[model samples]
Target: MTTRDPAARLLRLLSLLQSRTDWPGPELAGRLGVSTRTIRSDIERLRNLGYPVAATPGTAGGHRLGSGARLPPLLLDDEEAVAVAIGLRTAAAQAVGGIEETSLRALTKLEQVLPARLRPRVAALAASTVPLPGNGPAVDGDVLTALAVACRDRRRVRFDYHDHKGNATLRDVEPHRLVSTGQRWYLVAWDIDRNDWRMFRIDRLRPRTPMGPSFPGRSLPPGEAIDFVTKGVASTLEPCRTVATVHAPVTAVSERVPPVARVEHLDDQRCLLHIGAAAPLTLAVYLAALGLPFTVDGPPALLEALRRMSQHCAGAVSPATPAMSASQPRADAW
Candidate 1:
C-alpha cells in the first residue's frame, strides 16, 4: 500500500525518523504502508531537502537522522507547538542573563509559523501571565556552557570563587550536577582540596582554562541535589539559625515553609523545623506568619523577640474584649 499524497507521506516519514535513532528500510516501509522501493525514494527526497538523513549499507543497515550544518524546520504536533511557545516565553522572562533576547527572537519566529488555531491560546496565556524580574546576579553564558560540558563528560574543573565575605579562593572540583531554583544556578560538586561535597553559586565562579582529566563519577550526598544546594545555601547566607519543635506533623509543616528550611519528624504529631534569617525579628515574623503551634528554646534573642511581639499583640487588643486566650501554644506563646 502506498500513500496517494507524496507530500503528506514525506512528512510522516520525517516524523518517524525524528522519533527514533534508527529504522530499517523494511520496517519504515511497513509502518508507512508503502513498498521498500518507495521508502528509498522518500529517503532521497528528505536528503535533498537539507535534512542530514544518514543511510548505512549491508543487511543489518538502517537510516538515522544526524546533526547537520543547518537546522531544518521541525515537525511539531498541536500540543508540542503550544508547549514550545509557552516555554520560550518563560525563558525570555526568567532564564540566565544572555538568552532572554535570543528566546524572544525564536518565539517570534515560531509564532509566525504556528497554525492559526494555536495563536489565540498562546496569546491568551502570554497576556494573563507575568514573570517577576529576577534580582539575583546574572551568570555568564560561557561559564554555564563550560560547566555543563564538564558535568556531562565527568571532568574536573578549576575555578576562582568568591565567598560571601568577598574573599577569593581557587577551587578544583569534580563536576557532578547543576541545580536551578528558578532564581539562581548552583553547581554541586566534589571539592578536591576540601575532600568533600560543595555547592558553588554559578554567578560567583570564574572557570579557569584547560579543564582537568576525566574523573570517575561519585555518589551524590544523601538527598537530591536540589535539597543539598538549598540547605547549603540557606546555612551560608544567613548567620542566625535555630531549630524549633513544631506541633504539626512533618508533612504539614513542610508545606508552609520554603524548601531551604529542613523539616524532620519527631513523632506522629510533632516535627522539628530548622530555619534561619538575618535577624531575630525577621525570624519572629516568619514564625508568626506560619499560624502553626510551635515552641522555641533559648537563642535568648529569639525568645525576647517573641515576648516583644506578644506584648505588641496584647497592646493592640481592646480592654472591652477578654484578655487574649493563652491556653494554646503559638509562635508568640513563648
Candidate 2:
C-alpha cells in the first residue's frame, strides 16, 4: 500500500499512456495503484510538459495522447531502438542535401544512450557497411525541411527556380509531397501561376521567405508522384531526338536506352529507338556501346559520325605491316 516515488511513477504513467490509447481513469489508477484523483493530476502534469493528453467524454472517460507542437520523449523497446539507430546511420550517409550532419548528430546521441550490449552490434554494422557515392547535386537541408513542413500543414510556398535551360523565374505553389529518388529529391506541387501541377528539383529551388498563407490540401495530379516527376524531368532534358532501327528485341534494347526513351517493337528481332540526347554523336556512341546492330534514320549527321567512328576503330586495330610467316623476317643487322 506504499506510493511509488513521484519521478518513477510519472515515468511509469507516461509509458503506460504511450503504450495504448483510451485508458479509463479507474483502469489507470488501478495500474498505478493510486487513486483516480492522482491519475488526473498526472495527466495534467503530462500536458504541462507539452504532451497533448485528451480526455474522452461519457460515463467511461479515458485519456489519450493527441497531436501537439512539441515532441515528447518516446518509449522505444530494445529492438526498436536498434532499428532506429541503423536507419539513422543509413540516412546520415545517403540522405540528400545537408541532412547528413543532422542525421549524424542524431545517430551519435542515439548510440550514446543505447545499452552497452547493443552498442557493439550497431558499431559493427556501421563499420561494415559502405555507402556508394551519389551523383545528384546536394540540396539545401533547410529548404527540404521547410517544404516538407509546408506540405504537411497545407501551406503555399513561393520560391525562385531555375529551369533546365537556366531560365530563372519565381513560382508560387501548393506543395503536396517531397519525393526522394535516391539520387535526387523533387517537390510535386500545384503551380498557382500555371494552373497545373509541376515538379521542381529540390537542388534548384531557392525558397523565398514568408512561406505564404495556409491553403487547403489539393489532390495530387492524376498519377503517382514518382511517375509524374520522372516524366517531367525527361521533358526538360536537351533535345537530341534520334530514331534508329535496332536489331534487338524491345526488351533487350530498352535495357540500354534511357528510361525516358520510347521503344516500338517492329518484330521479334528488331525495334525502334526514339531517344533524346544533347547531340547526334553522343546518341550514336551510346547506341554503339550496346553492341547491337542498328541503322540510323534521319539527321544525316548521325550516320556520318557513325561511319567515321567505325573507320577510326578499324584503323586502331590494323597493323602497320602485313603479317609474315615464321622465318620470313630478316636478321636485324646481317
Candidate 3:
C-alpha cells in the first residue's frame, strides 16, 4: 500500500462518510486502500471536530452519520449544487428589494468555493438571465437600512406619512416587517395613526432620522408582511373607484382579479367589486374580460367612459384576423 498524507487521507475519509449512506469497515478500507486500523484513527479525527459517525456491529449495518455535536459541512449532489447557483444569481440581481449589495457579496463567496467545472456552468447560466424593472417606485438604501435595524431591535417608528392626495400627517407605528413584491418594497406595520396594519411603500417613506425606542413585536402578521403590504397599499387608491355587482362569488372574483383590484362579498354567489384605475378604459376592459355580468357604480365620467369603450370594442374584430392580401399587379394589364 502507498503511504499518503495522513491529514489529507483523513479529510478524504470524512467526505466519503458525509456523502454515502453507510459503509462497512472492509468497504471503507478497500476505498481508502488503507488498513482498518487507519480508518478508526481517521474516524477519531472527524469526531474531535464534532462529527458524530456511528459504527453498527451487524452484517446488515455499517457506518452511518449520527447526529453530531454541531452540524457538519453539506455534501451536495450535482442537482443541489446547480439549484444553489441559480438562487445566488437571482439574489444578486436584487429582485429581493433591499438586499442587492449583500446578495452580491454572498454570491462572490459562493463562487469562490465552486468546483472548477461547476463554476463555468454557473457563469454561463448567469450570463443568460436579465432583469427588467417596472414602473414601481424604488426605496432609498438608507430607509431600508433604518427600517431593518428597527425591525431587528423591535422598535417603534414615528414619521410623517404622505397620503395619496399628498396630505402629510404625523404617525407613530410599531415596526413589523418589510416585504418585497417584484415592483415594490413595503413596510408593513401597525399604523399608530389608524390603529390598523398598513403597508407603506418604501420609496414613499421619509422616516424620522432616529426611529423611536424598541418595543415588543406584535404577533407576527397572518402571512408574509409583503402580501399584507401589497394588499393595503392597493386598497388605498379607491377615490375614483368602481363599485360593481358581479355574478361571480367573492371568492371567485378574488381569485380571478389581480391584486391591483379589490372585491368584497355581497352574498354567496355574488360579490361587490371595487376597483380604481388611472385609465378607466383599461379597468373596464379587464373586468369585461371576466365574461360575467356586472353592474357598475362610479363617477359619471368613468361610467360614460366605459360605455363609450364598450361601444368601440363591441364593434371590433379579433386581432388575429389576417390582413387582406397585398395588392398584386396583373401582367395582362401591362
Candidate 4:
C-alpha cells in the first residue's frame, strides 16, 4: 500500500479516506509509507482538489471525508466500476418516472472512462441483457425523493391521496419505508388520522410542500416492510384466501408465484402456499396454471371450485383419450 509517485500517493490516500469514516493519522501514514507530516500535506492537497477532507488535531487526531458543496471525481477499482455500470444499465429500464434518462446518462459517462480491459466485459453484459417492459405507472421522481428524505429524517408528511375507487382525501402520515414490488411502488407509513399503519400507492399520492412536524419513529408491524405491504395489498384486492400444500420445493414454488403470495417451506418435497384472489374460481385457475401437483387446504368454496374445474376439464377431453387414474400424480393437476 506504499507508492513513491506523488499523484498516485494522493489518489491512494483519497481512496483510503473514502473507504472508512475515520482513520488515525499514524495509521494513514503507515499505510502510505510516509511520515505523519507528509500525510497532513496530502490531506491539504486533496482539499485543494475540492475534496472536503476534515482533520481533528490532538494526540488521537484523525482525518475523515466530509460532504462538500460539489461532488469530486471518485476513484473506483475495476470491480466497482463494472458493478456501477451494470447497475445503471439495469436502472435505465425501470419505470421510475424520471430516472431512466438520468441512469442512461450516468452509464454512458461510466462506460467512457472504464479501463480498456473492463470495457469489453461491461459492453458484453449490456448487449446480452434485456429488461421486461414494466406494466406499472411511472412514479414521480420528485415525490420519491421527498418521501425518502422524510423517512430518513423521521418527519411527518402531508399529501393528497387517491384510493382504489378514485376517492381523493387529504392525509397526514409519519413516513416509513418505500417498497417496490417490481410492478409498482408503495409507501408504508402510519396514518395520523386513522391511528393505524397503511400502505399507499406512490403514483396516486401528491406530496404537499412544507411537510408536517418531525415525529418519533415507531416500530414497524411484524415482518419486513415488503411483507407488510404485499399482505396488505393482497387482502384489499382479493377477499377469498386459502393455503395450499404444494408438492414442490420452496424455491420452485417461489419462482412460480407472484410476490404477493407467501410461500412457507414445509419439507424438501413440499411447501405451503398462502394466496388469495377475488373468487375461488380465480384462485383455482391460478393454481392450475402453475403446472405442478398440489392439494388445497382451504375453505370449502375453493375445494368446490376445484371440483367443478376438474369435471369441466375432463368433459373437454375426447372420449378416445386415455383417462388419468385418480391415484396418478399428474404434473399439470392440482
Lowest summed lDDT over 10 consecutive residues: which window, candidate 2? 325-334
- The lDDT values for all models are 0.88, 0.81, 0.74, 0.90
Residue-wise C-alpha lDDT for candidate 4, range 43-72, written one tens digit per residue: 999888888988888887799999998886
The estimated TM-scores of all candidates read 0.86, 0.66, 0.57, 0.88
Give the Cα-based TM-score of candidate 4 against the true structure. Answer: 0.88
Q: Model 4 clash tally?
A: 0
Model 1 scores worst on lDDT over the 10 consecutive residues at: 325-334
Local accuracy of candidate 3 as per-residue lDDT tens digits, 164-207: 67788777888888887666777888887687877777776688
Model 4, runs deviating above 4 Å: 221-223, 278-281, 297-305, 308-334
The TM-score, computed over Cα atoms with residue i paired to residue i, of candidate 3 is 0.57
Candidate 3, which segments miss by more than 4 Å at Cα? 1-80, 92-130, 158-171, 192-196, 206-212, 224-228, 243-257, 262-274, 289-302, 318-334
Residue-wise C-alpha lDDT for candidate 1, range 1-334, written one tens digit per residue: 5666999999889898988999999999998898989999999998898888999988999999888888866889999999999999988876586888989999999999999999999999999998878777878878988999999999999999998789999999999999887778899999999999899999999999999999998987536787898889888876677899999888888888865788989999999999988899888877877788999995989999999998998898888987547885555322
Error of 2 at 241 (Å): 8.3
Candidate 4 has which clashing residue pairs, if any?
none
For TM-score, candidate 1 versus 3, the one ahead is 1
Ranking by TM-score: 4, 1, 2, 3
Q: Report the C-alpha displacement of residue 31, candidate 3, in angstroms.
A: 18
lDDT of 3 at 331: 27
Which portions of model 1 show Cα errors greater than 4 Å? 56-61, 221-223, 249-252, 265-270, 317-334
> RMSD to the native, candidate 3?
10.0
Clashes of 2: 0
